[model samples]
Target: MNERTEYWWVHHDSRIQPAEVGFVGGIPVHFRFLGTAGQVRAESAELIERLPAPPTPVFRPPPAAAASPAVKPQISGSWLWFIGILLLIFVAQCSGPIFDALK
Candidate 1:
Protein backbone atom coordinates (compact mmCIF):
# COMPACT_ATOMS: atom_id res chain seq x y z
CA MET A 1 0.00 0.00 0.00
CA ASN A 2 1.34 3.49 -0.97
CA GLU A 3 0.87 6.20 1.66
CA ARG A 4 0.42 9.67 0.15
CA THR A 5 1.23 12.79 2.22
CA GLU A 6 -0.93 15.91 2.06
CA TYR A 7 -0.14 19.50 3.20
CA TRP A 8 -2.54 22.30 4.21
CA TRP A 9 -2.15 26.06 4.55
CA VAL A 10 -3.39 26.60 8.14
CA HIS A 11 -3.95 29.28 10.74
CA HIS A 12 -1.16 29.29 13.37
CA ASP A 13 -3.39 29.53 16.44
CA SER A 14 -6.20 27.11 15.43
CA ARG A 15 -3.85 24.60 13.70
CA ILE A 16 -6.50 23.91 11.06
CA GLN A 17 -6.75 24.53 7.30
CA PRO A 18 -7.81 28.09 6.42
CA ALA A 19 -11.56 28.22 5.92
CA GLU A 20 -13.22 29.65 2.77
CA VAL A 21 -13.69 33.45 2.90
CA GLY A 22 -17.11 34.80 4.13
CA PHE A 23 -17.98 31.52 5.87
CA VAL A 24 -20.69 32.13 8.51
CA GLY A 25 -19.34 32.13 12.12
CA GLY A 26 -15.76 31.79 10.80
CA ILE A 27 -12.89 33.95 12.06
CA PRO A 28 -12.02 37.07 10.02
CA VAL A 29 -8.49 36.43 8.77
CA HIS A 30 -5.78 37.54 6.35
CA PHE A 31 -3.41 34.62 5.67
CA ARG A 32 0.39 34.78 5.33
CA PHE A 33 2.35 31.53 5.05
CA LEU A 34 5.13 31.30 7.65
CA GLY A 35 6.56 27.94 6.48
CA THR A 36 5.65 24.37 5.52
CA ALA A 37 5.47 21.05 7.37
CA GLY A 38 4.82 17.32 6.96
CA GLN A 39 1.19 16.23 6.63
CA VAL A 40 1.08 14.53 10.05
CA ARG A 41 2.34 17.46 12.15
CA ALA A 42 -0.34 18.98 14.46
CA GLU A 43 1.44 22.29 15.05
CA SER A 44 4.33 24.34 13.69
CA ALA A 45 5.94 26.20 16.61
CA GLU A 46 8.88 27.68 14.64
CA LEU A 47 6.61 29.18 11.96
CA ILE A 48 4.28 30.68 14.59
CA GLU A 49 7.20 32.34 16.35
CA ARG A 50 8.79 33.67 13.14
CA LEU A 51 5.58 35.14 11.68
CA PRO A 52 5.40 38.98 11.89
CA ALA A 53 2.83 40.47 14.25
CA PRO A 54 -0.42 41.77 12.72
CA PRO A 55 -0.53 45.50 11.99
CA THR A 56 -2.34 47.84 14.41
CA PRO A 57 -5.46 49.63 13.05
CA VAL A 58 -5.34 53.44 12.78
CA PHE A 59 -8.42 55.69 13.30
CA ARG A 60 -9.24 58.63 11.00
CA PRO A 61 -11.30 61.65 12.07
CA PRO A 62 -14.28 62.75 9.94
CA PRO A 63 -14.17 65.89 7.74
CA ALA A 64 -14.44 69.25 9.62
CA ALA A 65 -17.69 70.37 7.87
CA ALA A 66 -19.25 67.18 6.61
CA ALA A 67 -22.75 68.04 7.87
CA SER A 68 -25.04 71.12 7.90
CA PRO A 69 -27.52 72.04 10.64
CA ALA A 70 -31.06 70.76 10.03
CA VAL A 71 -33.75 73.34 9.21
CA LYS A 72 -36.74 73.48 11.62
CA PRO A 73 -40.28 73.53 10.17
CA GLN A 74 -42.49 76.66 10.72
CA ILE A 75 -46.32 77.05 10.94
CA SER A 76 -48.09 80.01 9.28
CA GLY A 77 -50.78 82.05 11.09
CA SER A 78 -53.26 81.46 8.22
CA TRP A 79 -53.70 77.80 9.35
CA LEU A 80 -54.44 78.95 12.91
CA TRP A 81 -57.03 81.49 11.62
CA PHE A 82 -58.70 78.78 9.45
CA ILE A 83 -58.92 76.40 12.42
CA GLY A 84 -60.35 79.14 14.66
CA ILE A 85 -63.05 80.01 12.03
CA LEU A 86 -64.02 76.29 11.74
CA LEU A 87 -64.32 75.98 15.55
CA LEU A 88 -66.42 79.17 15.71
CA ILE A 89 -68.80 77.81 13.03
CA PHE A 90 -69.09 74.45 14.87
CA VAL A 91 -69.90 76.23 18.17
CA ALA A 92 -72.44 78.53 16.39
CA GLN A 93 -74.24 75.48 14.94
CA CYS A 94 -74.48 73.82 18.40
CA SER A 95 -75.32 77.08 20.32
CA GLY A 96 -79.20 76.67 19.94
CA PRO A 97 -79.21 73.23 21.60
CA ILE A 98 -76.72 74.39 24.26
CA PHE A 99 -78.87 77.50 25.11
CA ASP A 100 -82.10 75.39 25.17
CA ALA A 101 -80.46 72.88 27.55
CA LEU A 102 -79.40 75.66 29.91
CA LYS A 103 -83.05 76.85 30.36
Candidate 2:
Protein backbone atom coordinates (compact mmCIF):
# COMPACT_ATOMS: atom_id res chain seq x y z
CA MET A 1 0.00 0.00 0.00
CA ASN A 2 1.20 3.49 -0.81
CA GLU A 3 1.49 5.76 2.15
CA ARG A 4 0.27 9.34 2.01
CA THR A 5 2.95 11.97 2.36
CA GLU A 6 3.07 15.76 2.49
CA TYR A 7 4.18 17.32 -0.79
CA TRP A 8 3.41 20.21 -3.10
CA TRP A 9 3.66 20.59 -6.85
CA VAL A 10 5.40 23.81 -7.86
CA HIS A 11 5.90 25.63 -11.18
CA HIS A 12 4.12 23.26 -13.54
CA ASP A 13 5.63 19.79 -13.72
CA SER A 14 7.93 20.00 -10.76
CA ARG A 15 7.13 18.99 -7.20
CA ILE A 16 8.74 19.84 -3.89
CA GLN A 17 8.77 17.88 -0.65
CA PRO A 18 8.37 18.93 2.94
CA ALA A 19 5.65 21.26 1.72
CA GLU A 20 2.01 21.63 2.66
CA VAL A 21 -1.10 23.01 0.98
CA GLY A 22 -4.07 24.60 2.63
CA PHE A 23 -6.51 27.52 2.34
CA VAL A 24 -6.66 30.44 4.72
CA GLY A 25 -10.10 32.08 4.55
CA GLY A 26 -9.72 31.58 0.78
CA ILE A 27 -6.09 32.13 -0.23
CA PRO A 28 -3.77 29.18 -0.59
CA VAL A 29 -1.62 28.33 2.41
CA HIS A 30 1.51 28.00 0.32
CA PHE A 31 1.07 31.50 -1.07
CA ARG A 32 0.33 32.73 2.37
CA PHE A 33 3.44 30.99 3.65
CA LEU A 34 6.02 31.04 0.81
CA GLY A 35 4.66 34.07 -0.95
CA THR A 36 6.91 36.90 -2.14
CA ALA A 37 7.97 39.25 0.58
CA GLY A 38 10.34 42.12 1.16
CA GLN A 39 13.88 40.89 1.76
CA VAL A 40 17.46 41.33 0.54
CA ARG A 41 16.77 39.79 -2.83
CA ALA A 42 15.81 41.90 -5.87
CA GLU A 43 13.07 41.11 -8.45
CA SER A 44 11.70 38.40 -6.15
CA ALA A 45 8.14 39.65 -6.44
CA GLU A 46 8.43 39.94 -10.20
CA LEU A 47 9.67 36.36 -10.45
CA ILE A 48 6.77 35.09 -8.37
CA GLU A 49 4.26 37.11 -10.36
CA ARG A 50 5.76 36.10 -13.69
CA LEU A 51 5.36 32.42 -13.00
CA PRO A 52 3.27 30.69 -15.68
CA ALA A 53 1.01 29.08 -13.15
CA PRO A 54 -0.41 30.02 -9.79
CA PRO A 55 0.88 26.58 -9.04
CA THR A 56 -2.88 26.16 -9.32
CA PRO A 57 -2.74 22.56 -10.45
CA VAL A 58 0.01 22.24 -7.89
CA PHE A 59 -1.56 20.64 -4.84
CA ARG A 60 -3.87 18.27 -6.68
CA PRO A 61 -3.49 14.61 -5.74
CA PRO A 62 -1.28 12.48 -7.88
CA PRO A 63 -2.81 10.38 -10.64
CA ALA A 64 -3.84 6.99 -9.33
CA ALA A 65 -5.61 3.84 -10.55
CA ALA A 66 -8.90 4.44 -12.35
CA ALA A 67 -11.89 3.75 -10.14
CA SER A 68 -14.41 3.89 -13.00
CA PRO A 69 -15.38 0.99 -15.28
CA ALA A 70 -13.52 0.71 -18.58
CA VAL A 71 -15.94 -1.20 -20.84
CA LYS A 72 -19.42 0.20 -21.45
CA PRO A 73 -22.62 -1.84 -21.72
CA GLN A 74 -23.48 -3.36 -25.09
CA ILE A 75 -26.81 -4.42 -26.64
CA SER A 76 -27.52 -6.70 -29.57
CA GLY A 77 -28.54 -4.76 -32.68
CA SER A 78 -30.15 -7.83 -34.33
CA TRP A 79 -32.48 -8.52 -31.41
CA LEU A 80 -33.52 -4.89 -31.16
CA TRP A 81 -34.23 -4.65 -34.89
CA PHE A 82 -36.27 -7.85 -34.81
CA ILE A 83 -38.35 -6.66 -31.85
CA GLY A 84 -38.88 -3.27 -33.48
CA ILE A 85 -40.04 -4.82 -36.76
CA LEU A 86 -42.45 -7.10 -34.90
CA LEU A 87 -43.92 -4.20 -32.99
CA LEU A 88 -44.36 -2.13 -36.16
CA ILE A 89 -46.05 -5.04 -37.94
CA PHE A 90 -48.39 -5.65 -34.97
CA VAL A 91 -49.31 -1.97 -34.79
CA ALA A 92 -49.93 -1.71 -38.55
CA GLN A 93 -52.09 -4.87 -38.51
CA CYS A 94 -54.62 -3.01 -36.35
CA SER A 95 -55.41 -0.90 -39.49
CA GLY A 96 -56.74 -2.01 -42.89
CA PRO A 97 -53.40 -2.01 -44.74
CA ILE A 98 -52.04 -5.33 -43.35
CA PHE A 99 -55.52 -6.85 -42.69
CA ASP A 100 -54.44 -10.33 -43.76
CA ALA A 101 -50.77 -10.03 -42.73
CA LEU A 102 -51.38 -11.35 -39.21
CA LYS A 103 -54.09 -13.90 -40.04
Q: Candidate 1 residues 37-91, lDDT tens each?
A: 3332332311222213433337767657738777767668879999999999999
Q: Per-residue alpha-carbon lDDT of model 2 for 1-103, expressed as tens digits?
A: 3322222333322422222333345434332224534222221211122233334554788667697568866667879999999999888877675666667
In terms of TM-score, how similar is model 2 to the real structure? 0.25
Model 2 clash pairs are none
Error of 2 at 21 (Å): 12
Which candidate comes out best when scored by TM-score?
Answer: 1
Give candidate 1's TM-score: 0.26
TM-scores, in order shown?
Answer: 0.26, 0.25
- Superposed on all Cα atoms, model 1 deviates from the true structure by an RMSD in Å of 16.0
Alpha-carbon lDDT of model 2: 0.42
Each prediction's whole-model lDDT (CA): 0.46, 0.42
Q: Per-candidate RMSD vs. true structure?
A: 16.0, 13.4
